[model samples]
Target: MAWTWTLETAAGDVIRRSEDFESRGDAESWIGEAFGDLVTDGVDQARLFEGENEIYGPMSLHADE
Candidate 1:
């Protein structure tokens, strides 16, 4: 199954979806590295998916205050 992520705001509005990944691990790693940039772009959360099925998230991009 192809793995991907949906970038979104804190209010749950989607900004965009990421490029397709071959595996879940690769998708997760890419997010870990790119989330800094995403946050700067106004993304407050990310949701992981395997095709149309959500695997996890709405994970926060902000550092806990």
Candidate 2:
């Protein structure tokens, strides 16, 4: 199955949505590359929604400024 990444802000705001990939790793790498800066800027909240039932995050990370 393909993996999809959906990123959102702490307040439930959608920031970026990526195309489906063959692997979850690919999807995550895309998320990191696209939003790593925002994440490092102390925007520590995000969610990875995979499907209707498989939302994978609210992960808080320290993103460098």
Candidate 3:
């Protein structure tokens, strides 16, 4: 199954979605690199999905304050 991320704001509003990934690792790595820019663009968190099933996250893009 393909992996993807649903990017959202703190209020759970969807802002953007990621491209489909070949593996979970690839998805995670892309987020690791992109989340900084995402945060700048108002993405507050992200959820990972494998096909129709959520596999991980609502992971916060912001660091602890």
- Which predicted model would earn the best lDDT? 1
Position 6, candidate 3: lDDT: 98
Q: Write the per-residue lDDT of candidate 2 for residues 1-65, one digit (tens) a residue.
A: 66765556677666765577777678778767766666765355566655544567766544441
Ranking by TM-score: 1, 3, 2
Lowest summed lDDT over 10 consecutive residues: which window, candidate 2?
56-65
Estimate the TM-score of every prediction.
0.95, 0.57, 0.94
TM-score of 3: 0.94
lDDT of 1 by residue, 12-54 (tens): 9999999999999999999989988998899999999999999
lDDT of 2 at 15: 70
lDDT of 1 at 9: 90
Instruction: Rank the models by lDDT, top first.
Output: 1, 3, 2
40, model 2: CA deviation in Å?
Answer: 9.8
lDDT of 1: 0.94
Candidate 3, after superposition: displacement of residue 24 in Å?
0.3
Cα lDDT, model 1, residue 56:
91
Per-residue lDDT of model 3, residues 1-65, tens digit only: 99999999898899978999999999999999998899999899999999989987788899982
